[model samples]
Target: MLSDISGGLELRQADAVARALMTDDLLRAGRMIGQFCQGCGGAIGAVRLAMFPSTTRCSICAGSKLLAKGH
Candidate 1:
């Protein structure tokens, strides 16, 4: 399947990519209905949403979340 098409990619990498794609699709669908930040329940701006359709959080919350995770 995806691993074969990806030239024998590791199973874990393939799984991660598949999950990310699914999550991205779900987030995009949510935006189509009505956009909101999944992190802080804030309104997501149109420019930001357009820039990152799969984003689930506003910039402030996203930055904080990343910092919390030490990333």
Candidate 2:
């Protein structure tokens, strides 16, 4: 697959594969975040939860509360 991607003739295939990988990664990340936040006892928002799968806090607490976690 990598060789096909580098050969230049498979640009569309490469793009499709990359997009699929990205989507899969995002879904996996969201599951991880949901699992982590289950007992975290912190406030979270819908948009933040959707966009940032590794985030532990919403925007407000992100800068102050969750930032301490080194994310």
Candidate 3:
């Protein structure tokens, strides 16, 4: 679907940003409550939103956070 493509783009962009500006404490994503993505400041995908019910950042961002945490 068209929506799926757009969602992938958003996640890609978020991943790039997270990689560029990542620190230590800001892990596990931002947890924005709307259709927006707190990681890259983009829109959240419907599927991603459904999967990450409590997450603010996309899957990539969440993974990066977990990596930082060593888990």
Candidate 4:
């Protein structure tokens, strides 16, 4: 859809933009919710939460999880 609208954009760029827009919508909808990190027991900041609204895990925990997934 975004690629169709953004005719000049590369597929990767369009995908990124589409993802960002969708994520922004998700964050706006979930802004009031205080997402907690299960691993560190830390509160995820608004900026981080806005960037990643679908997950309860904070960036630090998410990064470690990703690292572990590679193993």
Candidate 5:
């Protein structure tokens, strides 16, 4: 039973670490793109689409781009 408890704790810790790393990566990507949204350096818009989405642009930017292309 103790082992099970410890395993759950470890899993939670791992999840926290993973989230931190992903946040760092997102910030790095946002910096490279040079955009901003809700003060997350543009990550807020892009993160919803997951890890750069289909382009370097954030969701809002991607939508605008699509519109411009008449898609």
Candidate 6:
């Protein structure tokens, strides 16, 4: 029983760490996306920006780039 409890605790701790790392990745992605848009002279919407937090540009910029590349 004690071992089981310890195992459960460890699992929870690992999950928490994973969630924190995911959040950090998201923030970094958002900053990069924002910078990309800035370079392209486009703007990201506040709501979408906040939601993604790590995206560099809004959907429009991404779509434009994709369309330009014929992708």
Find the candidate with the highest lDDT and give its number: 1
Between candidates 4 and 5, name the one with more favorable lDDT.
Answer: 4
Candidate 5 C-alpha lDDT tens digits along 4-40: 4567654478876777788999889866775454222
TM-score for candidate 5: 0.34
lDDT of 3 by residue, 1-71 (tens): 24645676544677656655664324435433355646666666779878876656666656676544642
The local distance difference test score of model 3 is 0.59
Off by over 4 Å in 5: 1-11, 35-71
For candidate 4, what is the TM-score? 0.42
Candidate 2, poorest ten consecutive residues by summed lDDT: 34-43
User: Model 1 over residues 2-22: C-alpha lDDT tens digits?
Assistant: 565489655678777887899
Q: What is candidate 6's lDDT per residue for 1-71, written digit by digit as tens?
A: 24645676554778767777889999899866654454365677777777877776666865676655743
In candidate 1, how many clashes are counted?
A: 0
Please state the error at residue 62 of candidate 1 in Å: 1.1
Best by TM-score: 1
Give the TM-score of each candidate.
0.44, 0.34, 0.35, 0.42, 0.34, 0.34
Cα error of candidate 6 at position 56, Å: 15
Better of 2 and 3 by lDDT: 2
Query: Better model by lDDT, 5 or 6?
Result: 6
Instruction: Report each candidate's C-alpha RMSD, comma-separated, in the order given.
Output: 10.1, 9.4, 15.1, 10.5, 11.4, 10.9
Clashing pairs in model 6, backbone N/Cα/C closer than 3 A: 29-54, 30-54, 30-55, 33-55, 33-56, 33-57, 34-56
